[model samples]
Target: MSNLKGLAHLRMSLDDIKSATNDFADNRILGRGGFGVVYAGQLPTTHRSACEPGTPVAVKRLNVNSHQGDKEFLKEILMLDSCKHKNLVYLIGFVSEDTERILVYKKEDNGSLDKHLGSTDLTWEQRLRICLGAARGLEYLHSSVGTEHRVLHCDLKSSNVLLDANFEAKISDFGLSKIGPKNMPHTFLATVPCGTLGYVDPEYAISGVLTKESDVYSFGVVLFEVLCGRLATVVKSKDEYEFLSRLVKKYYAEGKLDDIIFPGLVEQMKPGSRELFSNIAFRCLNQDRKLRPTMRTVVKELESALEHQLINLDDDEEIIGLSGSIGVYNGHELVTSLCFTTNKRKYGPFNPEADNRFSGSWDAGLFDGFYGRHGSYIDAVGCCLKAAARPKAQS
Candidate 1:
C-alpha cells in the first residue's frame, strides 16, 4: 500500500464507495466479467474527496465467488496510477474494506469496440482513428513515456479497449500488466501467458515468455477486427469457432483480400493505403515474435497510410487534402475529435458505447479543406492559410 501513498487522494472508504454506488444496486450495473461486476456510480460533489455531483463513474466490485483475489485488484490500481495518456482510461479512485475490494474509473460512456461488429455504417476513417489511438496507448506502455523501464499490458484485446465520450479509444484493464527491466530488450517469462484467446501471441503461448511484442500481436488482431468488422474469433457452428486471422490469411494468400474486408469498408479502401495497412498487419501477425514491428513502427505505418489517403483524394478535391488521411484532418470534425473540445451542447458525456457513434454521415463540407503542400497536417494547414492571405499581402 506504500506505493499508493502518492495517490491517496484517489482512495475511498468503503462507506463512501457504498454511498456512491447506492449499496451496489443491481440496476446500476454496467457490465460484468469473470473477475467482477462494473456499476455506474455517481459521486456527490459535496464529499471532500469526491468528483462533482452526477460525475459518472465506473465502480468495479470483485466477485466474492470468483477466484481473482486482492493482489490482482491492487495491481490494477497501481498500474493505472502509473500510466497516463489520452488513449488510456483514467482511474478515479478505489476502495478496500475487510474482505472486499473495489476499483473506480471515469465512466467511458462508449462501450468496448467489440460491441460494434455488426454496425452497418462504421467508416474506415473512424476505425483507423480508433486503432491508431490504441496503438499509441500501447506504445506508451512499452516505451515508458518518461521513465526508463517498460510496462507490458499483458492483456490487450478489443474488449479491454473502452471508448470515451467521443469515439476516441482508451486502453483499459491493467490487472495483468507486468513491468519489465529498465532500458532492456529482453523477453520476460511469465508463469502463465495472459491475454484473450484469439489475440494471444503464439510464442507466448508456447514459451510463457512475454514481451512488448506480445501486445503488438494482440493489437494486430484488433487491427484486423477493425478493418473487417469481425470478431477475432468467429463462431463457425454451434460447437466451434475459428480465428479471423487464419481466414484472412487464407483469403489474402489466394489474392482474394476483398473477401475479408468488412462490407461497407471495401468501397472506401484505396489500393496503396490498403495494401500498406495489410502488409503491416501481416508483419504484426508473424509467428516469429522478433519479426513483428515495434508499436512505434506500427504507429508510423498507420500514419503513413493515413497520409497517403490525403494524397489520393478525389481529383477535383485535390487542393483540400485531408490532414489525417494519415494527415491530421483539416475540417472541424477532425479538429474536434483530435483535440480537447468536447461537445458542450450535448447533455452528459456523449454515449457512444451502446450505439456506434461513428455511424452518422460525415458532413461533406466538414471534411472539405485544403492542406496545400506540406507533408504533415499542421504544415499543410499553415501553408494553405498563407496562400489564402497572399492577396491581402499584395494589397
Candidate 2:
C-alpha cells in the first residue's frame, strides 16, 4: 500500500482477513450490512491495557459486489481510524489487498440486535434496552462530532447494532454514513434512494432527500418495533396505518393512540407509560423532516421511556394486588406455553406457590404485560412459582 497523501490508510493484507474468516464461511458471517457482509472474525488483542485476561478484536469484510464499500473502506480508515464513540462501532483498522478490503472492530459475543429482535428469543424489556442503546449511539454520532460537522447513519436499524459482552449496543455499517459536507446546505438535499424498506423514511424514499430526519424516521420505525416487540417493517404493506408515519398521524389526529399499540404491551404496561411511548413515536415520524426529533432527542426520549416502563417498584405490584402470581421468569419469549388453570377455569399461568411475594425487577413486563393478559382476570405478575396478582382483570 502506497501513501498518496499525508493521511492515508495504513493497509494490511486482505488475505489475513480471509484466513480469519475461513474464506468467508457462512458461520463466520455476522450479518449483511447495507451493501457489505459483516464477518465476526477475530484478531489478537493489541490493546492489552483495556482488555480483560484475554479478548480478541472483530473483523468485517466487504462483499465483492459492493461498489460503494470501496469508498466506505477509505472513509473508515481516514475518518473513524481514531474516533472512539461507544455508540459508534470501534474501528481498530482495516486490511486491503488489491480488490478486497476488511474493516475490524472489537468482537461482541451477543452478536447483532437483529438476533434478539428477529428470532423468538428476546423479552420485551431486553428489546427495549436494545432500542435505547442503539438510539443513544446514533445520538452521540450526530452530536459528538463538532457542531459544524454532523454524521448521519444513512442506514439505522436493529441489524447494524452489535452487542458487546455486557450487551451494550455499538452501531456499525459506515458504508451508508453521510457526514454533512462543509460549505454546503445541511438542511436537506436530494440523493439516490438508500436504506432498508421498513425503516426507510417515506418522504426521503419518495423524494430522494437524505436528511438527518431520514435517520430519525428509521429510528421511529425501530421504536415501533421495540414497543410491539417485532421488526419495524415488512415489504408488502400490511395495512393502511402500518406505515409508522400514518400510525402517528392517525393517533394524533383521531386520538386513537391506544388502538395501534400492541395489545399485549398495553395490558401488561402501565397506562401512563403506554401513552408516553405513543407520544414519542408520534414525534419521531413527523411527515415533514423539519418537524422530526433529532437523534439526541430521540435517544433521550427512548432511554427515558425504557426507564419509565421497565422500572420495577416491587411495592407497586402489591398496590396493584399482584404481589403473588405463578409465572416463569422472562416468560414472554416462550412461544407455545400452556395456560395454567385455577378454580377449574384455564386462564393465565397457574399460581401453585401463592404464598411467595413477587420481586419486581427490570424484566417484569412478561408478568405485567405479555403473558399477563392471557385470561380475562389473570395477570403476568408473579414469582417463579406463584400465581400473578390480578388487581382487577387482565383483558
Candidate 3:
C-alpha cells in the first residue's frame, strides 16, 4: 500500500471531530445514508485548514451497523484522496479509531440537485452548468489521470450531485465507486450490480458486468430528468409507474417531445442546444453498451451545447460579462465556466435517507408549479463574470 503519511489529506483525530460537532448534536445532522449519517460541523482553525470554524463542513460517520467493511471504507478514503478535480468532491480529512470511522468534506450550502429538481428557480443555463460539471467529473473519473486505473462512479444520481454556494456542481458519494484494472485492454469489469433503483443501468442489472458505460446510462436518465423537471420514475396511477426514459422516448417517437419538456425551460432553451442535448441523451441511453459514446465524447457534446446556449443570449454587457467570467483564455483555447445560481434559503438541511413523498415520487398535478416559474437572465451573466476572474485553470 502507498504510505498514508505521504498523502495530502489530513489524518484527523476522533477527539477533534467530537469537539467540532458538539458530540453529534441532532441539530448538526445534515443528512443520512445507508452507509452512515452526515453532520454539519466546523473545524477549530480556518487559517491552517480548508475551512474555518465559522465555515461549516460536512462530517460523515460510518454506522456501526452498516454492511460496509474495513476494506470498502479504506477504498473510499483512498479514492477521494487520489482523485482531484474541480468538478469532483474532495476529502478534507478523516478519523479512524477503534470501530468508529468518519470522513470530512467541504459543505455545499445548496445541497443536492434532487432537492431542487421541480423548482423553477434554476434556469436552463444553470441546469446546463450543473450537467456540464457532472459530465466533466465523470470524464475525469473515466480518464486515466493520476492513476494507472480508471474510477467508475457506480452510484450516479441527482442526490449525489452537490451544489456549492456558487451552485457549481460537484459529484459526491464515493462509497459505491470502483476502480478499473490498470494497463488492461478490457472494455468492462465484472462485479455485482449495485446502484439506486431508478438510475441502475439495465445491462449491468441483468448481466452483473460493470463498466464506464453503466455510468453513461445513468447520466442519460439524469439528463432527461433535468430537461423535464421530474424524477427518473413517475407514478402514473396506484398500480402503475413509468420510467422517465420510456416516457421521453415515447414522446420523441411521436414527434411531440415538447409535450414533456419542462414548461419554462422550453422558452429558455436554444434550438441548437436542445437538439444537441437530446441527441447526446439518446446515444447515452443506447441499450447496446458497445454503441454508447465514451465519457470524453459526452463532455465534448455537453460543452458544445453550452456554447450554443451562451451564443444565443442577447449581446449586452451582461452577456459579455457572462462570457468573460466563465471563459478562461489559456494560451489559445478557452475553457468556459461551469457555475450556477442557487437560493440558499429555499432548501434547508434535508434527510437524504428519508424519502419524502412529495419530493421522491410524482403525484397528480405534479406538473402544475413546474410550468409557470420564472428567473432572471442575469444570473448566468453574473456567473460568467465570476468564472473569468479566476487566474488558474481547473480540471
Candidate 4:
C-alpha cells in the first residue's frame, strides 16, 4: 500500500477532505450508490495547480459497511491513474488514511447521464453525441491507454457516465474494473459475475467468464436507455421488474421500435440515423458473445448515425428563409421551435410554438445551410452563407 502513495496522483489528507466536504454533510451529497455517497465539494489547497485554490470537485467517500472494501478502493485509484483520456473521468487525488477511503475527481457540472434519462430537454443530437463519447472512452479502455493491460469496465451503466458543462460524456466508476493482456482477443477471466441487475451480460452471469463483450452488453443497455428515455430496469410490480433489453429486442424484431422510442426523439431522428443506431444497439445484446460488435465498431456506427442526423439538402436547393420561436424551459433559454424555407418549398415548423417569435429571409444569394450550438436544446442557431451562382450567360 505504501507504493500506492508514491504514485503520481496527489495524496490528500483526510483532514483536508473533511474540511472541503464539511465532514460529508447531507446537503453536500451529490449522489449515493452501492459503494458509498458522493459529495460536492472543493479541491483541497494542498493540490492546487493552475486552477483556482478552491475549485469545485466531487468527493466519493467509501461507506465503511460497503461490500466494496479497501481492495476495490485501491483498484479504482490504480486503474484511474493508469488510464487517462478526455472521455474518461479525471482523478484529481485521493485520501486513503486509516479507515477512511475517499476519491476526488474534477466536477462534472451536468451530473450523471441517468438523471436526464426521461428528460424532454435532452435533444436527439445530444443523446447521440453522449453515446459516441462513451463508446470512445470504452474503446480506449478495451484497447490500450498507454498500458500493457486492457481494462474492462465490468460495471457500465447510465449512472456511471458523468456529463460536463458542455454535456460531453465522461466514463466513471472503476472499482469493478479488471485488466487483461492487450494482445489477446479471446481473453477470458473467470470471476464472480457482479454488476447492476439489468445491465449485466446474461452469458457472463451464467458462465462466470468475464470478457470485453460483457462491457459491450452493458453499453447496449445504456444506448437503449437513451433511446427509450428510461432506465434499463423498471419495477412492473413488487415482485416483477421489466428489463429494457428484452423489451428493445422484442420491439425491434417486430419492427415496432417506434412504439417504444422516447417521445419527441423520433421526430428529431432521420430514418437512416434511427435505423443504424437501433441496429447496432440490438446487435450488442446478442446472446452469443462472439456475435457482439467491438467497441471500435460501435464507435464507427455511432459516428455514422450522427452524420445521418445532420441536414443534407439536394444539389438544387438552398435555404431561402428561417422561422423559429425562443422560449425558456426549466430555467434555460433555448430555441423551442424552428422551420426552414428552401427555394423549392417550405420544410416545416418543427416543435412549433408562438413564444418570442423571430424570422429572417433573403431574396438573393445562396443560403448554404444551417449551423448552431445545441445540447439539451438548441441553445442558438445561425445560417450558413455562400455567394449565389450567377445566371449562365446565353449560350
Q: Write the per-residue lDDT of candidate 3 for residues 1-395, one digit (tens) a residue.
A: 23455544477878888878999999999889888899988886532466555567789999978866566677778888778888888688887778888888888889989888888999998898889888888988887554578888998999899998878889998888888864653357888888987788899999999988999999999988888999998777998878987888788889898899888999999898899888898888888888988877887787667666654322222211111122223453332322211221111111111221222222222111100101111122211223344567778
lDDT of 4: 0.85
lDDT of 1 by residue, 286-390 (tens): 888888999988977886566444434332332321212222245522221111111221111111122212222222232222222221222333222223334
Candidates, ranked, TM-score: 4, 1, 3, 2
Q: After superposition, how far is residue 2 of candidate 3 from its true place, in Å?
A: 12
**Model 3 whole-model lDDT (C-alpha atoms):** 0.73
Write down the RMSD of all candidates, one decimal each. 8.7, 11.7, 13.0, 9.2
Q: After aligning candidate 1 to the native by TM-score, how far in Å is the CA of 204 from where it should be?
A: 0.3
Write down the worst ten-residue block by lDDT for model 4.
Answer: 371-380
Q: Please, what is the TM-score per model? A: 0.79, 0.67, 0.76, 0.80
C-alpha lDDT of candidate 2 relative to the true structure: 0.61
**Each model's number of backbone clashes?**
13, 13, 4, 0
Colliding residue pairs in candidate 4: none
User: C-alpha displacement of 309 in model 1, angstroms?
Assistant: 3.1
TM-score computed on alpha carbons, candidate 2: 0.67
Of candidates 3 and 2, the better by lDDT: 3
Model 4 TM-score, 2 decimals: 0.80
Candidates ranked by lDDT:
4, 3, 1, 2
